[model samples]
Target: MAVLLHRLGLGAYRHRKLVLGIWLAVLAALVTCAGVFGGKLDDRFTVPGTESQRALDTLGRTLPEASGAGAQIVFTAPEGHHVTEARYTAAIAGAEAAAVKAPQVKAVMGPNVSGAVSADRSTAIVQVQYSVQRAEIRPSSLDVIERAAAAAEKNGLRTSVGGSAYGSNGVHIGPSEIIGVGVALLVLVVTFGSLLAAGMSLLPALLGVAVGLAGLLALTPAVSISSTAVTLALMLGLAVGIDYILFILSRHRRQLARGTDPQESIALATGTAGSAVVFAGSTVIIALAALSVIGIPFLTVMGLGAAGAVLVAVLAAITLLPALAGFAGTRLTPKSGGKQAQRSAAPDGSDGRATLGARWVRTVVAKPLLTVLAATGVLVALALPAADLRLALPDNGSAPVASAERKAYDTVSDEFGPGFNGPLLVLTETHDRPGAQAGAKAARELRDLKGIKAVLPPQPTHDSAQTVIQVMPETGPDSPRTARLVRDIRAAAPGIGEATGATVAVTGATAVNIDVSDRLSDSLLPFTAIVVGLSLILLTMVFRSLVIPLKAAVGFLLSVGASLGTVVALFQWGRLADILGLAHTGPVVSFLPVILIGVLFGLAMDYEVFLVSGMREEWVHTGAARASVTDGARHSVRVVTAAALIMFTVFAGFFPLDDALIKPIAFALAVGVAIDAFAVRLTLVPAVLALAGRHAWWLPAWLDRVLPDLDVEGTRLQKASRVVHREPERVS
Candidate 1:
């Protein structure tokens, strides 16, 4: 494996111009194709075989108007004025006319006919129904609708639009990618101290992300994915890309400083760090692939898309980075006479006794018990809030306060009720018109329920075979208490429908949200267990250690738990809610657990591999576990911390996005990267390794023989290190 990687690196450098030109051509082709044929992304989540979906399908067939994407054109009258006033009425009419003129709009129902005028007559809602599916309606069409609604302001009326269509148009998914790249560039420059070096590291990452996004856009017709998928693909791609380049670049620079020729240095660097990159990238890919086990088509597409991008990033790191480094030559190293140059002068690492990291490791080894306990305690305390985590889909209540959707949500909640923003649709199949009366009785019964605020009268379908009732609850969509109301209604629905001789199902935005949340919640434990178990097995094979893999898994879980707790506190409990731009306090996003587990666990294992591989090499050569622990920690800390900082900066760049779904994701990943890299990898893992001593590397002979040689750090070059540099007890 090391030989193959070394050859690939050498080849990349030998034909550097060809490699660069090929990548350029690929990028050009991908961008050209994307501009001409790329499809727009949209959110179209649905869970088949669920009661909510059944109800939705029934409604779509019986009443086509309610089938397509929906939007509400909201109008507010002048202060202390009634919506029925001449000017306000004219404004409302004008807004409706504008909506009607939209080619995509199938119908515009409003005022008295739609029962949308507020009781106080100060506000009104005009329902705009589209003929096209939600994903089929482009943002430009929504822009036309927004402009039409804006005309109401000319008549002294304040108009705003809200719903899936408007909210979809509000998302700017690609800007965060640019911000992430900018931050990564800065981090690389500061870490490497050379513009050429930094560009070499960042260039491949940018190209990989661009190509990945272009491919994702082109794949949209065959594989359905949301706009959120775009953000995630770019985020993960940029992060992994930069880290991959950093790993190889750091090693290549170290070799150059050691007096090796540039070609041999690049090849050896690739053989070692490139091997780790391959294993780490595979772990990430496998973790993401686990999402396929959940059986959700859209999520599967999203996970695979991200995994594909990561694959590209890894490949680019091995090929494109080396080629660029070849071009960079001596400029990749720092100038003479500075601290870096002084270190470079000590090529054999024989200039001194110990580094700060080695000293810290020695101290921890002297009292491993205390260090391990203290680190464990800190992790446990930070993770406490995770036990009380609540999960739900972000609703209008969670949108940015400045958004039209959020304003509409606030206005409706203030005037009508929080529940008005997410009403439940009760659909029932009945034999005849007499069953409509029974449906009305069921609606009345719903009104008597504890959380019920209001239940509108039942209306029969055009064929008179089905009846639909809209029931408004007292709580908002994202309320922690809302799911209970859904549970209660489902519990009571059967008896009520049976008595009425009808078959009933609950469906709507609120019901779909509840169902999706429940499904995700149910799957979280098993899915997490699978991911952890798979990672543990992989680690066990790579490191040839029983205790090391177990300890690594525990440390990773600690980091993930603590990060989730931080998100729950910030996004769910509303701690720092105002500062974070969260419109309201509510449950965290339902899929956060699975997503966090996959991403954080993969990264945790990645660091463990990079750090431990160095220690494994030292131990194998010196036959002294304690010294190897100190030496490996000393050598790897700089690169590991730099990589972590780059990842943190890229993730943190997304904080200002203010997309409720993305903000928490960004926060969790950022916090997790910080904790995993600094706390778990730097402190806890080393302490545990120190305590375990030689036991940390113990693997049963039979199992060792059975397991595959992962070659995680390139055994060929690592063995060469011992023979080439024989200085005892060096600074590293």
Candidate 2:
């Protein structure tokens, strides 16, 4: 691999113009296609084979009205005022009439409808039923609904349009995203110390991200791409792109400072660092692509989208970065007597003054047992909050506080009851016509359920073989009690069927979300085992050490545990909510843990390979475990620290966005990267390696022979280079 990468890098560098032009042409083509072919991003969360999904699909086939998206135009009258007043009633009636006239609006129930007005008459909800699913509901249709509600707002009523159909799931790029890139550039500048070098490091990464994202968008017309998936792809692409380029660029500059030929340095850096990049990126790609095994469409899309972006970043790092280096020639070399030059000239890439990584590793090695205990204790303390972690799909109630959906959610909770926002549909299907009696019996049985707040009369379809009954729960949608109620309803379905001669199923927006959450929760354990097992095998292959891989896996778990705990504490438990700008806190996003494990596993392994490979290389060359640990720390610590900060900054940049879906995921990745890179890989890893001594690199001879040599550290390339240098070139 190293030899092939060396040849590829040399070819790209020698043909820099062609390489640069090829990337540019690819970028242009993708961007153009995206502009022409990109379609709307759907936010639909569908889990096939779930009971709720099956019921919903049946309704879509038999009774379209019940399966279509529903929106609520919640109106709240002023304090001490009543919506029963003639003017308020008239305005709400006007909105409902207008809503009915809107395209694709099948039905609009006004405040005059039974149970539509609050008991105190201070609030009313005008329900608008669309003839399409949430994803298919046109924006213009929603616009008409909002415009129609203007009359109610003028009548001294607070009007908020919200519901399943009003969800804002479009990917919007804001100042925060730009600021993240800016911060990443600042990190690059500081790390490289040369503006030209910094810009060069950032350019290839940006180009790679552009191509990746553009390609993803271009496929949106054919695929049901979601906003969350795009945001994740962008986030991962940018973070990894810059980090990959930085790794290779930093290595090239180090070699340049050592007075190596510019072309030779580029080849060597790409061959060595680029090899690690490929191995590290493969771990991430494999982990993400493994999402297919879960059999969830949206999650599979998210994982594959992110994996595609990372793959592009790796290609750009190995090919485009070296080509760009060829253009820069010797200019990237640090100036004589400069800080970088002086540091690079040292035996361990540090000047007379010891680097912080070196000093810290020395302190850690001096008390390996204590270091391990202290680090583990801190991680354990942070991980305690994970025990309290709750997972749920976000709903209107989880929207930004200032959003219309949240306002409507709050008003409905305050007036009509929280359960009104997420009513469960008890679907009853009979084998024959005139099944009204069975439907009525099913409704009667549902009313007797423990969590039942109210069971509406069954409304049979034209054939009378299917009946839809609305069952409102006592608690809110995201409430644990509501999840329990969903299970209770399903459990009671069999008894209801036996008593009424009708097959009953539970489905609604709320029930579907509950099913989605349950599916993700059930899949989490097996998915984690797969990821952890993959990590063990991959790390073993790269480092060729049983103990190191084991240590790396343990360190990964600690970082993941601590990261998840922090997310639970901040986002779920609402700890420091105000400081973090959280509008509301309840359950964490259902898929966050799965995503964190997959992404952070790859990244944790990235740092693990980069750090441990250096140690292994030094150990192989000198057979001095203790000295190798410190020497490796001194050599790679600066690049690793810079890379982690760049990744953290890029991810943290998305933390402040108003997007409920993107915000928590970004924060988790940011926190996870920081903890894994700094605390585990740098601090705990060195301590463990120092303590393990000669045994740290141990591998059984039989096992070693069985495992193919990956040569991620470029040992073969290093020996080949030495052989070439020993034999002088003959003029032909």
Candidate 3:
């Protein structure tokens, strides 16, 4: 393929020129297409699900009955007595005036501000509703909410504003993208040392993001993505961009040091490193594609967006990066002897460590059975924690500075109830025509529910087919009481709505997450079966042996599990939580395992294919399984490590987001890359392959006879590509 590419020179560089043109077209299209994702649509609007989803939907209808935009706020103090007459009037008056001045706020109903103080009188609950439009998100509404929430917080009062649309959006997903990008870029700047290079390293990121966003636009007609799309795009983009550029740049630097003419060097650097980049990129794509098995739209879209971005970014790295490197000249060349450079400047990139991995590979090829047992043991150990897993989505609200909003939420919970700010949406679907009668029954049932503090009157929805009921919980949104209430609601809802003959499915962020988990688990077999099964097929075709593909699948699973276990031990298990500032180890983001497996599966395949292909090539030549495994490991280990390190550095560097959404996924990915690169890809795999011997290829003669022969390395294309060198252009 490399020779074919070289022979086909893209007019200027022949095949190299072709790669350049491909990059130009892909990047331009990706950049231009990303704009199509542009629209007035906001993806963050939470879809309906388990509890809160039902609550929000139901509350939207109930809001009008209470009139005004139907809002509430609470204030708390440690004192045991009610406010003095003067203090009460002043606080109430202050709230009233603030409401009046706030635009789009028709009025502040209830709380009366003066009364509604808690039983202890230390806490004051103000239930205020607006006679305004429902503003899930509007700049005007945002401004009003921020100002009103801030102004309403008084000197002696601890205030919190709940039931405002603007407040929810601002708290949950705000400034997170800024923080994620800022943190990721900061790491790259430190790693690269040159601001220009650091900036250059971001090309893949920009490209990846651009491509992912473009893909979102392209895919929007088919799938409704989350409002968190941009954030998700940024995370995947940063990792792919950094890793893609890291590998290519490392190769370029190595080439420059070897004194290859700048242009010819460009060909070699891109051909070798670019091939690795392309392969790794394909692996990422496969992994993200694995998320298709997850029934949740959130994970599905994220997987698609991330995988698509990675796909484009990989193409960009090998094609476009080399095109640019063709112009970078000496800029890519490393300075002599950084501290580590002085220690070892060998071409093998090992910092001169003993080659235990290759030696083990040799031993394993001699004893394939022993290697299988060993790899299986390592995998079982890593997978055990996964068996005990549970899932939850916590508020985990850590602001830039602990803001008034969070404190206010706590204060309000103390005064009114736990669900003051968080409401659960109850969707009651009946075979009978939807009308007030069904709603009345739902309302009564809601009010009777144990945690139910209030049931706003049911209202008709845009669909008009379902009635929405908003039920407030007895505890704060994130408290255990709320979660328990959510579960109880689900259990009781079906029976409660039975008289109305309404079918109820509870859904909110919390319930949606629970549903998502249930759905994800349900789909696990099909998803796993698809990825694992497809991988075996790809390997079967690539290696032309049934035994080899199975072995590859086994090794890949071990590496992925062990990698996951390492992450679980550290992040989820509380080993390095504090050190990483991710002290919240609440069962990991509900969707992380799926994302991790998808990614790790692909990467494991990458190592497996690269190693297995090399061994197969040698085996075909030597007709000795043990020698083939040993020699293949010896020759391919360096390239694999270099490829793996580039990916590892890029992923590990982006670990500081610390968001509930990103922490587990990022940590899991980092561990997968590190362990795959170091342990499984290096030491364990080779040892096992060495141990498997001829018996690893177990297909009956009839099956072997029928299979098509295919080989990835040491083929005619490889031999031809190595033979040609385009004339080197003088360094620009």
Q: How many clashes show up per model?
A: 0, 0, 48
Instruction: Name the runs in model 2 displaced over 4 angstroms.
Output: 729-732
Model 3 CA lDDT for position 259: 58
What is the Cα-based TM-score of model 2?
Answer: 0.98
**Which TM-score value belongs to model 3?**
0.75
TM-score on alpha carbons, each prediction: 0.93, 0.98, 0.75
Write candidate 3's Cα lDDT for 62-143 as tens digits.
4443322334555554355454345754675576566566555544554453345666666665555554434333466546
Q: In terms of lDDT, which candidate is stronger, 2 or 3? A: 2
lDDT of 2 by residue, 1-732 (tens): 988899899999999999999999999999899899888787878889999999988888777878889888988889999988988888888898889988889878786664678889888999998768787888889989999877779878889989889776677678988998998899888887899999999999999998999999998999988989988999999999999899889888998998788898899888988899998899899988988788778899999999999999999999999899999999999888988888876767887898777798889888999999999999999999999988888888878899988898999898878898899998898886567899999999988888778888887765678889999899989899999999998899999999999999999888988888888889998998898898888878888889988998889889989999999999988899998789879899989999999999999888887888888878988999899998888889888999999999999988888877888999999999999998999999999999999998889999999998888868889788877766774422
Please, what are the lDDT tens digits per residue for candidate 1 over residues 58-123?
Answer: 777776555567788788888899888987787788778878878778788878676777789888
lDDT of each: 0.81, 0.88, 0.58
In candidate 1, stretches whose alpha carbon ends up further than 4 angstroms from where it belongs are 138-148, 169-180, 333-338, 341-363, 431-438, 717-732
Task: Return the clash pairs for model 1, or none.
Answer: none
Angstrom error of the Cα, residue 84, model 3: value is: 8.6
After superposition on all C-alphas, the RMSD of every candidate to the true structure, in Å, is 3.6, 1.5, 6.5
